[model samples]
Target: MMTFKFARPLAWLLLAFIIFVTVSPIGERPNTVTMVDVDRAVAYLLLGFAFALAYPKQWKMVAMLLIVGAFAIEYLQYFSPTRHPRLHDAGIKAMGAALGLLAGWVINRWRETKAPNGLPFAER
Candidate 1:
């Protein structure tokens, strides 16, 4: 089996992409599905996945960072002239983060199970 290593530069690029999608005004217009909310949620989810992929052993840290990042962004919005953060938006973000973390845990657990000499479900 191939040993997969996380590429530091690629990870940084992904982080930059997440930040751009999170704060950019390119999708500020009102529309069905609410592009801003969707993008924010997706960004959070992707961020969680990225962190998990890069540091599979640091799942708790990933979760903490996601929650803190969401809260910080919401707080920042209060001072932004163009944006006022909504409680509902924060709730949506939190839910997205939770779902993303859960997905990451599931994928990681599955990978561990399939690894050579990994403990079987009954043993674990």
Candidate 2:
């Protein structure tokens, strides 16, 4: 049974990075990345997955944060001088979040199976 005390901090760091990337000026980004919508989704997917791992006991909060964060970031983009908000991006973000949640669930289940204590048993 391995422990990951670093997961929370790393997840928060990644969340901040995602926020920076989202709000920064378009010209500030590198030219190498293509498929803007897909990229946004993938970034959010990773964010969601990381947060899920970090807060395994608070999945509802994680879900709300991911959803709200995705939409809020896109909404805030309207104020950016070089960026305009798009619902399309939000849509892709939702899809990515869903997939990330599923991945995290699977990872957590595997972790529980491998742990000496096993998964938490519900109280009767």
Candidate 3:
């Protein structure tokens, strides 16, 4: 991730943003043209992608965190007076994360095939 050195930190920032948007007052949420489900899917997709790219060796842990965190974070919405939470939404988010994880894994494998030593400059 030399070309994207900030992936790890950025993943954390995205998680923070997700938490804020999930539990904050409805009025504090930003408006978007896409459907609400689509928004959640995309947000978690990127979150999973970032985490996968950042910790390529920890796919199992990352998968657990992103998938479980989806439901865990959604549960937080139950406590918000202005926000409504649904299992459907959590499922969408989890699926999106799973797709993202799959994509990242594909990319990681491709990179490994192209660079056997895990370095662009290393002799094949």
Q: Quick one: best lDDT, which candidate?
A: 3
Q: Which stretches of candidate 3 lie over 4 Å from their true place?
A: 1-3, 116-124
For 1-124, candidate 3 gives per-residue lDDT tens digits of: 4324787898899999999999999999989659988998999989988888778878789999899999999999989999899999999999989988888777776776777465642122
Off by over 4 Å in 2: 1-3, 118-124
Clash totals, every prediction: 0, 0, 0
| lDDT (Cα) of model 2 | 0.75
RMSD of 3: 3.2
Residue-level lDDT for 51 in candidate 3 = 84
Q: Which prediction has the highest TM-score against the true structure?
A: 3
Q: Sorted on TM-score, highest at the top, how do the candidates line up?
A: 3, 2, 1
- TM-score: model 2 vs. ground truth: 0.85
What stretches of model 1 exceed 4 Å from their correct place? 1-15, 18-36, 118-124
Model 1 Cα lDDT, one tens digit per residue, 21-114: 4454535623436576786687667666666655567679878877777777676655546666777777677667767777867877787778
Clash pairs for candidate 1: none
Clashing pairs in 2: none
- Model 1's C-alpha root-mean-square deviation from the true structure amounts to 4.7
Cα-based TM-score, every candidate: 0.70, 0.85, 0.89
